[model samples]
Target chain A: MLLRLSWLLALLLAALPARGAELRLLPPGLAYCDELAARFSRLPGARQDAARGLAAEGGRLCEAGHARAGVARLRRALRAAQGAPRLARSAHP
Target chain B: MPHTRRRQQHPGPLWRLLSSAGFRFALLFAVVFLAAGLAFAGVLWWGTAGTLERQTDSAIRADAMALAERGRDSGLAVLAEAVEERLALDAEGLSIYLLLDPSGRRLAGNLAALPPPRSGDSSWYRLNVEHEDTGPGEARLLVLDLPDGSKLAVGREVSEKGRLRALLTEGLAWAAGAALFFALLGAWLMRRALERRLTPAATTAALIAGGDLSQRVPLSLHDDEFDRLGASMNAMLDRIAHLMDGVRGVSDAIAHDLRTPIARARNGLEEALLSEADDPATLRGAIERGIADLDNVTRVFQAVLRIAEVEAGARRAAFAPLDLSLLLADAAELYGASAEARGQTLNTLWPESLPLVGDRDLLLQVVANLLDNAVKFTAPHGTIVLSAWREADWVVVRVADEGPGLSAQDRTRVGERFFRADSARTTPGSGLGLSLVRAVVQLHGGALWFEDAGGPPGQPGLAVLFRLPVAA
Candidate 1:
């Protein structure tokens, strides 16, 4: 009986907690992220700023993935300004 | 000693007696302990093997996981880097890691091509890694499912763990050595303990063998089983020694005492021969003197024959179911003549049908010997009887006499061979008659009694009683 208890303890010790990022799943095309972004904005003030940055950067990321250079450049400009505000807030906070 | 030609070592009864209990116990202890040690050794080996196997598996997996972290690309590039890095760490490392697409195509590492992922656990496998001689004989590889429609293959083959093998070999040696040491130790202790207990018995036996009748095994304060056995042996030896002493004295007395009459008769014959015996009348008297000497010698030989026959167990073979009443009648009829010849009265009383299982001839002889002694020793007009009855499971026979009885001291020593009352010593008979009677009664799983019959101041001549079992 004591041997069995030691066996369980050894196995439990060996199963360490996973330490790196895993795949943050996304749906096909652009539907699920937009829905998530909309729900994100409806939260409180700090959440609203973070949500606007995600929406702008999410669009630019799609453009990059699709390889539309003109669309990507235009969105990058928009996203850069939005991204700068969150960075400033985060740095101050 | 070997398992063949056992007939070549056939020892006599002396060897068999020496090697009985001592040898048997020693052999039993050895065989059982050896088997137990072997079984324990096997269990120890199995337990160590399992521990070593599990440790090897985890060590190789840790090595692969650390290598996998450094690869810069997914699938194919990661596998190549993991394999290359592991080889650089240990030149002969037989570790193989493969990542494959769903279509069974090689995606990474040193694997030139991918084989299908196993359906279940497998035996030794071929991975696309290549190495020169002194390579692993066979590799242990497992296909593990990864989350992205790909799989991770991980394993390594080490010839053996050198340290574990060394420890196992050393452990087995120690275990065997301990078994041998303890077995010898235990056997020595057992032999010593056995010898200690047997010492008293051995000394007593040796004393008896050397014709010393006074030796006895002493008991100790512990009152243990060995003490009991020693005490019992002492009691038995006492009995046997007493019997042997009585036999020796009786024979010695018979030679010394009985020879007087023979010498007297022989001297009478010489005197007659030297005298002027010219007539046939004188010659006839000399012949009578020689006949008496011959009669005494014949009586001595007859007595020896009767006692020897009783002890020979010959009568025991003639045992059968018979009526005790019939035996009593025969004893009365057979001895009735002698009683009448001496002008004595003889009577018989018995149950109608007293059934008993015994040697009928011996039982009859026992009764006859008692009646004969009664009639011979009784005075004229004395009463004698042959009686039998059944009490419980035994048939009891009694021969009572109304003659001058044996004194208490004489009655006790009456059955010793050649023992005779001073008055009855003048009678013409061998003294072994009653001894033979007692032996026959004893051999039939029965009892005998020598009790006093009625007399004036002291008990009269003895009443000899005997009993035989009805059903054996």
Candidate 2:
């Protein structure tokens, strides 16, 4: 009985590693999603409308338990909200 | 050895140049030029770089006002949108903009973050910014608080203006260097010209100091100031040389003329002393002859002293106004008896009044000397004419006789001290009479001349004429 108990403990340890690996593959947490939403809301100009639509879709996905997909959409929304004119653009032609 | 020592004592050319007036003037010129150039640079800086900076600040202020007005009339969101649009339109990326919410989070425009806030409602800030396109640079911004609790910042990068100012400063420095070089060159040239112009006079002075009295300063055809100075120096040197020659001539004449009378007087006395018989009559005669010879020598000395005194202007202080005609008449009357003794007719003619300023005794002596010469040289039964008159601004006196006139060469030399004419050599008088006459006339500012008396061909007599300036 003691031997069986040792085997069960090793199996449980293996299962915990698998779960941690799976969590690593998923998107970031709810805090990151909230930050991206704030950034998107602050964006200026007409290009922000498309980013607003993408953020709404990401919020719905997160509510439906597709956290990885929702996080991906939120990231795409933030990039779009940055708009056509960016700080990284060169001053000279 | 002295010449070598003098050469060694002279300074080098560089030292001379530094001490020269021309170099000093050049240094003054360079200093003035540098000051003027710096002043001009200051003005240019104000006109170009300073003006550009002011213009940039004005534009930034204008943009900030516009953004604030938009936020006031419409909303903070519209103001943010306007900032983004302006950043998109700026092709050179020189424009800078930042819109911040009340929480200090950047919402739009190119800037990543808002600058430090100040207490004022609106403020200007000069900040070092890391531009996304142009890297690090300076920016001038005007920050304004919007009505909706948002902030708008408008600015322009000023690195290009700084670069232009630096270029202008470098160019002005080069120009100043070139001007200094030219000023030094001009100073050296001016010193060379000054030394060249003065060399001739310096050399002549050196030669003269070494006992070469004939050396003179050379003149240039330019007839400039230096040439005029050289000419004046030459004239003074000539006058000095002439006076030296006159002194030598006077020495020779005194020795030659005085020796004869002294020797004769000595010989007569010696003969009397060496005689065989001790005779009183012979001794008295010899002694009397010796006295006469010594008296003649004394007379010559007295005449020389009188001439020297007159020439020295000693008699000028005793001058007073007197009628020259009256003086002449008195002299003629005194010498008339002498002319009568010689069987010569003495005739006098003069105006009633001939006023002039002179020494009366000296003028009388002048008339007496001419009349005596006339009486001595005139033939017996000849007419001796004495006349005086006023001619223009002068009192003229004339004495004419049927005597042998002087030759042309003797006329030029007549007034020289102890000079006697060949024709008058046998006469029993000193040759200082004409010289004394000349000295007295010159002292009184008068003129004297000898001319032909306009007599018969073989008897062209001498006429002594003189004129004194009329008294004012």
Candidate 3:
């Protein structure tokens, strides 16, 4: 009886659409966020703590299925990274 | 050795077209039009694209100024909030903004990074932005340092504007290509038109060169430029043919007239040489007759040369203003004795002064020849009249004699070299007298003709009249 109930539950779970499959329909802002994040990562600077924090938050949001909010934050992080000097510099100098 | 004939090489159609005046004119016209088109395109590009760029720059400048004022008044926090709000409102995602703290930390906006600093913080910069949806784009940016040790960047993506400019440039290129095509077509058509108009003249000329003197350029009733040109060419051909006929007639007459005298002289001399008896009187008589015949040939040659000289305008340099009346009186006085000796009454009527410009010797010779003909042709006791008068712009002279007038056919042939009326064939004079008179009168810009002198029935005398321009 227990084995039959377990098989029935497994079949029900298989019949429902998967979350990963649903997430495959990419949001409009996801590509933009990825572009901004990639650009920020390539920037050469020392004092990028604020940008790093924002980028981390944006990545968590995107992974949590909040793509629009993630893109907004990633854009702000990119703007912050732009303020950094081209050469490395001390954060509190 | 057999001679090999070389074939003539004619230019090809392309070569002819390239060398034609019509094609050159068309090319020049096309070049001028292209230059004008280029100038017009340049102006259009400057007016449209340039104005759009200027407006974009102005908008960027004004936006940066407004943002700077806001940042100054409301502090960094408010400025950052305003930038975020503005970016959220930009549905096209063309707006670009960046704010930086003193420590180079991201505060707000959409730019991936600050562009490398140029000369100063206040200066404008052009940046390439990588947009996810639209590929790479150009942005006009103004980066400014706030009073609180922060920086702000304000810009707008201008990819659409760049695309528009590219489209305009492409259109201009296409327009230029089309213009070139039409210009070449026009040149080809113009060349063909010119060739069509000129072909008749060229063919006629070729036929004439091949010895067909009767060939003439065909004409159209349109009377356009080409028709006028054909008419002129035809007129020229007619004149050439007429002159050629005259030359042929002169050659035939010379042969006929010269052969008789020469044959006569030769026969007389040969007879004298062959005589067995040594008769001095007969030999002397033959020699004298031969000398007279030779002298007659010499006179004919001299007369021919004089006519040619007059026709060539060689004696025009000797022309002078003089009283034609006096010249006529002189001629009458000189010929009067000959006329009287011939048993013909000589009479003169003249104006005291008939002004004219002419070569004096030629005019005197003309008068003398006319009087000589009159005196020779008039019957015994007949009347000969010499008269001169000024009429209108002309000085008129007439020599009338009581002799049989010329037939209409003879009148037309009178001035031709070696031509003579059948009635005057027995008269003692070369037929060249009237020819010389005609040449002299023509050279002096005068007209000469003949008419009946109005005598009793069966005595209709001849009147030879000439008129010279008073100024000539």
Candidate 4:
């Protein structure tokens, strides 16, 4: 009976993540947490704190089915994490 | 001769260089090159400075637009704080800024003073701007009035652009100077080379002009244009020398040949006068003999003059197309009686019409002289043949006689004035007959030559052949 109950718990764990709303936010076959973590890993050490905080908030929004706002926030996090250069070298004046 | 030679001086190197055609060409090229270079440099300067000025104006307008929008969104104080923040950046003095109140006093920013405002989308004005590390610097400025009665100024320092322009101007000046120097040097070198090529011809000309007829322009094996000209001039000089030799020969021959006849006539008269008896018949006979000798001498002079006139090409104006066959027939007829009296048969072989362009009277004389020579030389019962026919582009007339032909040595000298073959010295005629024939032949653009008519060795008959160009 204990083994059966353990198998049932395992099944439930796999089924729960697959059924979550954040699954749609990931690219096909990718896990939500993994995509967020990949972005998190590319952040420079000096900028990791801000990027991590933003990515965490974006991941939570994806889980709540706010995919549009989540994708926008994720892009901002990706930009900060990647340390992209400015679009233009604007004059200082 | 030595004194005369020493009088001519060598031309100086400077004079030769200056006089060379190549030097003139090079100088002209240099002037044109420099003028074009100056124009090109001016265009480059104008284009580069104009581009920089446009870029600065564009940047100022964009910055002002952005700042004006920010000022509209927030208050004057916030815009002032933004301007201060921009000036505070660690960017090295490439930037300028000025914020002024309605009273026109600087409230915030880096610029120390602004010029009067001008109207345009973006107008450039000169400004002095203060920097933390570099004290005050000159800048290009653009000013805009805000809705709150404040003025915002944006500018860029001109020192870097000015430094680049100064360097470019200096480079252009040096390039122009170097171009001129090389042009002059090239011109000088080219002139020297041209002078070297032409010097020999000039020297030869000077020598010839100084009365040395034997001097000729030297030639090399290169066969270039100058060499060809030298060769042609040498040929002309050779022809002139030959003519001079011929003139000298004629003069010497006249001095000796005329002296004999005059001396004979004088001696005859002296004998007639010295005879002791009063004899009118002897005196008359002597006078007649003297007159004959004088006539012979006069005939020689007349023949010489006629030959000279024919060779001068003056009779070419009287040339007309005539039938050579008819002329041949006329000559055979004219000399037939003389040939018959000598017991020689005169035969003529001519085409029905043998046309040629020549002076008719001269050509008739030519035929007459040839026939006469044949009639005079041939032995009794010998054959004299006169023939006329077209040979290729020429009208050929041949007079052959069964007489002693000229020896090879005699043939070479036969057509010269006063020259007679050893065999023909006993004949009663001046030696100028063949010479006159040759001159007439040459005047008609024809050739005259002799050949041996078939016979035994040392007894071949003389065949005189002459050819004239057929009339077109």
Candidate 5:
């Protein structure tokens, strides 16, 4: 019986993905995060840390299997990445 | 020619572009296009941004309701757990949540603190929550007062909407710039093409204005406006040249005709002064001859002025309807005695009452001139026929003379002022007789032409034919 229960558990685990093991199984949250990180890299060094932090959080949510929430987080990360350079330029100037 | 030479030193391309009409038109188009583009962009921004904002606000409200229901179903402990789960689920950090205790301490969610609650039932805030992580951004917050006096808040990031608006604005600006560049280029090309077509006419006009009367506008096979203008200008130039030649001829004839008479009078006076018989009859005879010579010169001048007045068209006011057949018969009758003395037979053909509108004196002079020329040029015993008849809308008059007819070349030039036929140069009288006749015919809106009156094969004499319009 214990062995049958362990097999059932294995089937359930297969049905519900553990996390970012299969990226295609999730939403486009991680892909969006990567795109935003690439854009932020072009900004000046003074504001790079804040942009990286936002992207890292978005990637974490995507890895944790919260796809819908992950997409929203990634969108926020992109906005932050886009806005950082302008804010840095203004603050420094 | 001098003007054309000056025009060849044209200004450079840049100067032409700045001064060209096409450039100004293109600039006007650019300004209008920019204004229209801005208006379109504004409408696009309003539509897209407004939709995005409304959607974002609704999502925020839904999130707030979900959390409030979660708290109502269980307690603050369960609500706080749900907030933690949501924060973990949201990898993008776009969702916001906060659970506050009765003393207002933030218990859960991504935000650092519970923002101060508002007085109204619902309100939106532009305040920044994750300032250290994502810089400043727009957020719509909804704070709900829990049954236990604690607070729950939810928000969604709205900075992406702003980014979209920025991208659209930048795109519109770039498009407007590209449109202006292309418009200016097209305008310059158009101006160049127009200038190429117009340059020839402008050059010809400049040359003509610079005292080159012989210059004429060039023509093309294409019957366009420019070609028509060239033809009209060429015709006008030809007329001016013809009139100039006429003036030159009249001046030469005046000098030649006056010199002989003046010289004869001077010689007679000198001879009388040198004579030893100082009698009054000899002096009176010399003075009388001089007076006659002066009178002849005076008559020539008077005839020239009369012809000029008729050609000026000022005698049209004196015109009235008169019977042309009667007028022809009267002229033939008046000259019949002279014709008989010269042993010439005068015949008349009349269509009873041929009517015309003209100056009576001028018409009489036309017939009289033709008759006088016939008498002067014809041999004795020649036949003269005077005829008047109506043909279509005109009254045709003919005074056919059996005289030595003129050549075709002489007939063409006979109506020019002071133009005398080569065969008749030795005859007495000024060469203005036929010219005055032509001027009178034209003033009456008629035509005067010469034809060979049919007679024997080799003796076809001149026919002076005139046609005048019958008045309504």
Candidate 6:
């Protein structure tokens, strides 16, 4: 029965829909960027520079008018920051 | 919740649209291609409108700043002429603009007047600016009092936003078309996949309906859901074939097995009927003969039922490991004595410790049946040999006799229930021996076959082979 269930899961996976690969980063403004960064304070402090680099990349992308790439990169940066130690300090503050 | 339930009861339009093959294929094709087209239109609109708006806003601001740097009255005159040129009534097309003072008077612009702001109006509005000269509606750009006190307005004959919106609407219509196209393509693929699956099923059903009981549906790669369906149908047909053959053969078997003793009983009864004295010994003989015939009939029915039960495999629970060598020895010894009395020599070759998994009674019966068949088939002065040994995975037993070997065609039908070889039609035994042998062998998950036991066929006979699985 467990084997049967696995087979069914495989078939279900085969039937899944394809989706566009896209990302959205620091909206059009700095305020939007800061608000998003605060939300993404989960990244480790050690990784914060990496996150910043990614955001810079996203900014570069947005400048190039590739908003999808920009958003994706920014989202990745925010996700990385979600684990930041500084977020714990600010949670109560 | 009720609405949800109702919705479930009544499938959505999208599902209905998806369910139809034509619609689904068209939809899939349309989704891919039309999405491409729609995405193209959207990007076109965004790029054109955004660039135009940015340029216009910058141009207007620069013009206003330049004018405000001059004296206010002179600037107003210059602005009027500039505004007139910049905001010339959009080719008499309503793509126009207006600059209004804080009091709602047009400071210097081509627009006739400013309509009161719609309720809860925001920073900017894309309004359908109308015109008496042009047709129904025209789009306009309106700017209010500037911080510098020089109201600025500039318009272009090209209505980018309006055109973009029109383009988007067109794109959506195109998207819907693309959706239909994609749906059709998907449905065509689905049908082929369905056909690949459905074809074997339809063929199998046709095969069955056409009376080919032995025919089977071939399994495909993956053994998918369709294969499951095929397997299920195959099982059903298997049962049907068994029953149809079983009923005809069973009835015939009952008759053949019963008739020998029945004829004996009739002969005895007729003698008693014709006798002058109703003698006690004569009556006893008649009654005994009748009883014997009835008993034989009962035995035949019991054998049939036992074979049926074994084939059903439900009695595998009663299965146990048994000594196969001992069973063969016993059959050979018993038959050895019987054959000796019948003027035939019995030979034996029993090996040690053939650890086999089988029902003791069934294994014993299999050995007994083989020995009995060899003894019955061979003539007087013939030698019957019974032997056993382990080979590969099976404990095989052989019972060969000095008798006439069955032809190839006859050998094939040897295990069929109630099938007696034409030469054996005059034999006094029921044809159920080898049939029962087959049933027992199958119950043990083994096989029975014939082999040329490499002896003189005249006095040392046809060989019968039985193989059973040896316990690991």
Best by DockQ: 5
What fraction of the true Cα-Cα contacts (under 8 Å, chains A to B) does candidate 2 also have? 0.00
> Once model 3 is optimally superposed onto the true structure by TM-score, how far is the C-alpha of residue B187 displaced, in angstroms?
2.3
Measured against the true structure, the TM-scores of the candidates, in listed sequence, are: 0.60, 0.63, 0.73, 0.66, 0.62, 0.57
TM-score of the A chain in model 6: 0.43
Two-chain complex of model 6, DockQ on C-alpha atoms against the true structure: 0.01
Ranking by lDDT: 3, 2, 4, 5, 6, 1
Candidate lDDT (C-alpha), each: 0.63, 0.76, 0.79, 0.74, 0.73, 0.64
Compute the lDDT of residue B41 as modeled in candidate 3: 73
lDDT for model 5 comes to 0.73
Task: Write model 5 residue lDDT over B34-125, tens digit each, in one string.
Answer: 55665675577668766776777777766777778988999989998777555543444556667888888877765656555557764555
Ranking by TM-score: 3, 4, 2, 5, 1, 6
- What DockQ does predicted model 1 obtain? 0.02
Interface RMSD of 6: 23.5
User: For candidate 4, lDDT tens digit of each residue in B203-275?
Assistant: 9889988999999999877899889888888999899999999999899888878999999999998998898
CAPRI tier for the interface of model 2: incorrect
Docking class of 6: incorrect
CAPRI band of model 3?
incorrect
Q: Where does candidate 4 stray beyond 4 Å?
A: A1-93, B1-178, B273-278
> In order, what DockQ does each candidate have?
0.02, 0.01, 0.02, 0.01, 0.03, 0.01
Best by TM-score: 3
Worst 10-residue lDDT window, candidate 1 chain B: B84-93
**lDDT string, candidate 2, B298-361, tens digits:** 9989999999899999988889999877887889889999988889999999988887888999
- Candidate achieving the largest lDDT: 3
* Global Cα lDDT for candidate 6: 0.64
Write out the backbone clash pairs for model 5: A58-B91, A61-B91, A73-B92, A73-B93, A74-B92
DockQ for the candidate 3 complex?
0.02
Clashing pairs in 3: A80-B106, A82-B113, A82-B114, B357-B472
Report the CAPRI category for model 4.
incorrect
Model 6 segments beyond 4 Å from truth? A1-93, B1-122, B132-137, B140-246, B270-274, B343-346, B379-382, B457-460
Displacement of the residue B265 alpha carbon in candidate 5, Å: 2.4
